[model samples]
Target: MVANDPITGQGANGAAKAAAVHLESILAHGDRPFDRDFQQAVADRVREGARPVVQWTSAMLEPAPEHLLGLLVAAAELPSAADRFANGFDAAADFGQWFPDPEGAADHLASLAPRG
Candidate 1:
């Protein structure tokens, strides 16, 4: 399938994830023919994994939101936070865990903060 441009930085990441999903699905098929069901299942799995990354990249194209901006600021000061943000590009599924909303981002940032 054709994909978006690399401007949002998800082209390579999404391709890698799709490859992994295909590999896993093929392995799991285990002697079964790669039939229509198999193809559909693979498509579903890849779509599930890709949805968050797609959403995150779409949001990024818009003006930055408050919580996203806050997370960026915190990432500058917290190595863990920065790493977490960077890691999302590698495993965009993680974006689903913490990138969608203000509360999740704040909690993630707080957890990355150093103790007194």
Candidate 2:
């Protein structure tokens, strides 16, 4: 069964994505038999889509680094930054652009600073 950590707070989101994958796969298969191969292919597709989300969720489980904490604080005061972070929940892959390391996080925060 396809399942994910509920601690990630993505159970509903993941289920929705899985349902879409299943429906798309079924439609694309046309009259093909629902055999083990087809099921495996669908599972693989789901895993591919979910990989980034899982990575982000796993990261969240770890203790936050100072830079990450800074981002959180900035997010509270910056509406745009907060929105981007909120959007990341739906587009978890976006987290990869800036959420993984100190350098990326710093760069992202800098970008969010108001240009003079």
- Model 1 scores worst on lDDT over the 10 consecutive residues at 1-10
lDDT of 2 by residue, 1-116 (tens): 35667777887898899899999999999997999999999999898878778888888788988988988998999998999999987988888889888999999999999999
**Each model's lDDT:** 0.83, 0.88
Cα lDDT tens digits for candidate 1, 22-57: 998888889989899899989988888888787888
Backbone steric clashes in candidate 1, count: 0
Candidate 2 Cα misplacement greater than 4 A, ranges: none
Clashing pairs in 2: none
| True-vs-predicted CA distance for residue 25, candidate 2, Å | 1.0
